[model samples]
Target: MKSPSLSTTAYAGASNGESSERPPFLRMRGLCKSFGHVTALSEVDLDLREGQVVALCGDNGAGKSTLVSMLSGVIEPDDGTIEVDGQPTYMTSPLRAQELGIATVYQNLALVEQRDVAANMFLGQEPVRLGVIVDRARMVDEATRVIQRLRVGLPSVRTLVGDLSGGQRQAVAVARAMLRGSRMLLMDEPTAALGVRESRRVIELIQEVRSEGQAVVVISHNMEDVFDVADRIVVFRLGRKIADEERAGLQREDLVSLLVHGCRSEEAGER
Candidate 1:
């Protein structure tokens, strides 16, 4: 496994008078979205900082997917603002989001099952030789570097992605995102539907990615996994933010209450 040789100065704080006290690496204010008569999101505000891992938690129909889609540029928000580095910007499409250094790894993994690991990693952006042929050697080498950098254990880059375990396939998707020069990674249940050990590996990989100084927003219903990797947790209910709290001094039951009842225990008590 080779190490990743990418510079993270762009996402890292304290560059050119940008101090820690300044705005977050990414910010969304008053974001709202609707489909026909149904409101998908309602005045949502969120912030993410570089090198931080935030968990997005909510039950079904809680607007988690809608919020992520807006951030990833799959769909634009009907109203609100997205700010990168404290500058207002528009996310017109997925390509525009990538141009802004935001990448999303959806739950499907999005790998060509028949393709080899290296091929899947560089699917759309393959290295070319002499402006004509695909450079197979360089592709494999770069894939090896990304796998090693993420510390994901795979037999070889030449191995088919279909033959890899669930965790390995997830790693490939993440590596593909990283190869695109992503400064912020948004993962949708990267650890879902795997054996205990495989799920553990994926969670570890998320932590490793955060260690590389990239902002990560993970969407998961598994409280255990969320507590394991998330520095902060945000909960959405009925298309609105219900809770945004640091992991510090937070209890498991407190989070469960927010997901199920749309309020903390004490708040429920008042009700």
Candidate 2:
């Protein structure tokens, strides 16, 4: 793979008195979402800092996907606020979220099976030449550039996305996020169904993205993958945040229990 030329400043901490350009580029405070009588997310507060990888952990229905959906603009919260650089903002829609530089890579790896790598990355927004023609060269060049930005290991830009390995396909999906100049990325199980080596490659690529001054939020049930890449771990249970612990201060079972039952909040009133 060709190496990408980049600057160390790509992932620098915020110095303009804004919230540190550290991990977590976005934060939701007192966020709530409901459907009819049931609540999918309740008073949830989460953060996504630049250059930091946050692992969101929980059982199947712990509102993991729902919360991210709201953050990604697939859904809008009925209550609370979203803050970027400590300033409150509204996503209203996915396009608005993209304009805010927040991107989410869904679990299905939404690349068109019929499209090649370049085609997939530039799916609906292909670069146009002079007036009315597909700028194939520019499309491929930018596609290749973004792939390297994430340090993604791909066989070729011309390769069909469907033909790539599970990990490679995931890489392509992630590279698509860069096309929007995303500052924050939410990935739903990027390593799912991959062999050990392939999973490692994807994990490494994720690290590269984080190193490039971007924030990554990973939703995974795999504790091993979480430990392998996360700088901090956030556990959710029954649509509520249970714990937000740094990786060095916690263990696998501790995180697991927090996901299953929450890290026993001392707030007796909650209990």
Candidate 3:
């Protein structure tokens, strides 16, 4: 499978709740990372626009984790520049990325099982009283508002996170990220361990997040999930990007071929 040329103009254009003049929500150019003699990534460039779900697909060891790791500030790139809203910035730590409106929701979810939905939603940034106290009422109200807005279908904000289903728990994680005014969400295998119905709920959640005008980068191996929710697909192989195409004209088989056999020797021979 030959790489599809990415359209700069298409990516630069405005989408729902996003401004055309504003720099792309997130942009990376000439990104490179290495450890000793192993090159994890080389000259990788990527762009994420507000209100779009771009799925990053690849087999294991394809550098998908490395790319997301750098974006989440877990590790610094060996060479490259990162830009947010058109301004060059350094993401030296995960906290810095969160401060810059970038939030990462890993597979573990990092939610406290003992806490309820509202409590988990505003865990660290809980609203406080005049002096010093957690404003329980305000927290529940805000949590309810976000849940209703996203239509996540939680029974109640007070329900314990541990009691909620897998999809519901994932919803809480996503809602928590949104509470911090995050503009872009990096979700890792959100629906990995879910059943059909639960996976559907999570797929709906991803769409709802995109509808809210937040840029979303979903790292997924499930072809069904990727095709169902992604506006674009980016395929990486052997630490390099092999294809970047809009989901409209892309076939699942072609994507699978690229993943299993980079550049597809049979197809290359025919060409």
Candidate 4:
């Protein structure tokens, strides 16, 4: 399997019909990371525009998680640079990533089972009144507003997070990230362990988020979900990026070939 040679300019001009004149909202250049002698990522470059939904697809150990970790500030790259909104930035920590308008929703969802939806939404940065106590009233009000804006159906903002269904819980997680003013969202298998109906709801949620003009990087193994929600597809293999192209002209089989053989079907025959 051969990794395609993709330059930043070539990626920007890919046939998505998006204007190449507009600069990407986020850019990663020559990102590399290694643990001891094992390289997790190598010279990977990616560009993302506002309101774009990019599906990161690959088999296990394909460096998808590693890349997401770097973007979320869970780890630092051994060599490379990250640019946000045309400014070079360092994601030193999770808090720094959030401050830089990046948020990550891991597979665990990270919601407290005992807490209500409003409480979980504003967990660490709960609103305070007069710098003395937690302002429950304001918290609920703001939570209600964000929930309504996202159109998430729930009994109430006061409903316990543990009581909500899987789909509803995923919505709450995304809503919480949005409330934090995050411009980019890194979601790890958001629809995993969900039923068909629940998965549909999550797909809708991703679409809604994209419509709100936030860039989304969805790490999903489900090909149907990728084709349904992604505007572009990025395939990683063996710690290298194998393919980066718009999703419009791509078929599921083509993506599968890339994931398995690291090349298109025709190219596979040549190899």
Candidate 5:
């Protein structure tokens, strides 16, 4: 498949409450997006802590895609700031995001159907040994080590991503991001099309990423997925943040109420 034309976003984020020792994974404030006269995202603010999983949820047209695009550098926000690793920086493109140790696994998975897992893992950025030849052996070894590091349960490194099961392909896609030395992953509905077991495996892989201390921004519509893995839940309603709850006291329905109705009144009362 043709890779999406990736570019870096021009806006840079902020650094707040982040330490000198620890890098600020990502920060955003007053993020806004519009096309013609239609506002897609407005005044959206987000902070991604290191090693934490943040679930970004909203109904369609609620600004999830716009935020992801800006974060992943698919499109620039009309207004906002973005900071990475404690430094204010602009993600001018997907490659620039990669340079900042940020990687995004889009909903489509972006695998080349004709290639094997190793090739897929190193797509666009292939390792070289003798000037122009790919470091085939090192690529395989590193790919193997990455899957092992993530505790991924793929049967073989030689498996073609296309031939693998849906969940396995998701694993490959995520693994590719990890192998590129990404410190954070912005996943877009990773389990949207997978079977139960496949989805479960993908969940486990995400856990492994967090265990390794890399922050994650997971965008999913599945409550189960959110409740199973998120450290924080940020719900958006009509281009605005309605609720930002820690996993400690937040319920699925409470977040749903904020997302679906933008009303808090007594979301906890239902429980």
Candidate 6:
């Protein structure tokens, strides 16, 4: 497999003022995965900088979710190397990923409808006082702090998650990830199935997260949302990365062409 060139200006710099001289926060090389007869991903290389938002754009079955699953420890790559902080690492499980400061927020949000925001935020990792009882006060206090930090406008952390709107639920999920000390968030279709106003709220939340110096990987089919939030865009096609480019100067038509035809008109001409 050919190594991805990182010397390009597109790979340099980050919104948080991180020096390009530093290694990427996360890097994958020669990544591959398969399911019996189907190749889900092949020879894929990716880099993610700290405090940046990288959008994964592709049609269905383009291998976006496969790559995300590998990163989140939901599945392992059939072959490849994953590096964190320039050191080789294996994401063995969801717990291991969390331990490594990586978190995934799926479209469902994975929230407990019956529980309140605070309870959901601290779900499995709830604090304990004296190792005997759940620390409700600490949980609520920390939840409130995270919500404020994310600037999510919810009625209260004590409000039932089921009663919250879709955007509000997304906020709860994100706050929960932050509360768990996750430094990188892998979000899948964060704005799907929401009204225009609600989707806008989620988009703003993503920007807020980026401004706070956290890396975010957003998988979305919505081009508007992608352009609105991503610092860089990576396009996948039929189990391979066809394009990885900065969002600036990339027209929606060209991006659409890449997603549908796997190449821009100029690239097709060159071919």
What is the per-residue lDDT of model 1 for residues 169-258, given as tens digits with 9 covering 90 to 100? 998899889888999999998888677788877877887788787889999978888877777789999899888876754678899988
Q: On residues 86-130, what C-alpha lDDT tens digit does candidate 2 reach at each position?
A: 788888898888889888787898888778999999887888987
**TM-scores vs. true structure, each candidate:** 0.90, 0.87, 0.89, 0.92, 0.88, 0.92
Show where candidate 6 strays beyond 4 Å.
1-19, 269-271
Worst 10 residues of 2 by lDDT: 1-10
- What ranges in model 1 sit over 4 Å off? 1-19, 269-271
Cα lDDT tens digits, model 4, 1-271, are: 0222222223324424655676787899999999899989999999988778899999999999999999999999999999998899898899999998898888999999899999999999998989979999988999999899888899899999999999999989999999999999999999987888888878878777877888899999988788777888999998898888787667778899999888888766522
Report clash pairs, candidate 3: 1-263
- Tell me, what's the RMSD of every candidate? 5.6, 5.3, 5.1, 5.7, 7.9, 5.8
**lDDT tens digits by residue: candidate 3, 79-189:** 999999889989999999999899888889999999999999998888999868999999999999999988988899999999998889999999998887899999999
Consecutive 10-residue window with the lowest summed lDDT within model 3: 1-10
Q: Candidate 5: which stretches are off by over 4 Å?
A: 1-23, 265-271
**Clashes found in each candidate (C-alpha, N, C closer than 3 A):** 0, 9, 1, 0, 11, 0
What's the lDDT for all of these models?
0.84, 0.78, 0.84, 0.86, 0.79, 0.86
Best candidate (score: TM-score): 6
Candidate 3: where are CA atoms >4 Å away? 1-22, 264-271
- C-alpha lDDT of residue 50 in model 1: 79
lDDT of 6 by residue, 1-271 (tens): 0222222233225453434678888999999999999999999999888788999999999999999999999999999999999999999999999998998998888999999999999888989989879999998899999999888998899999999998899889988887778889999999887888888888878877877778899999888888777888999999999888877757778899999888896767522
Q: How big is the positional error of residue 90 in model 4, measured in Å on the Cα after superposition?
A: 0.9
Number of clashes in model 5? 11
Between candidates 2 and 3, the one scoring higher on TM-score is 3
Model 5 compared with the native: what TM-score?
0.88
Write the number of the candidate with greater TM-score, choosing between 3 and 6: 6
Descending-TM-score candidate ranking: 6, 4, 1, 3, 5, 2
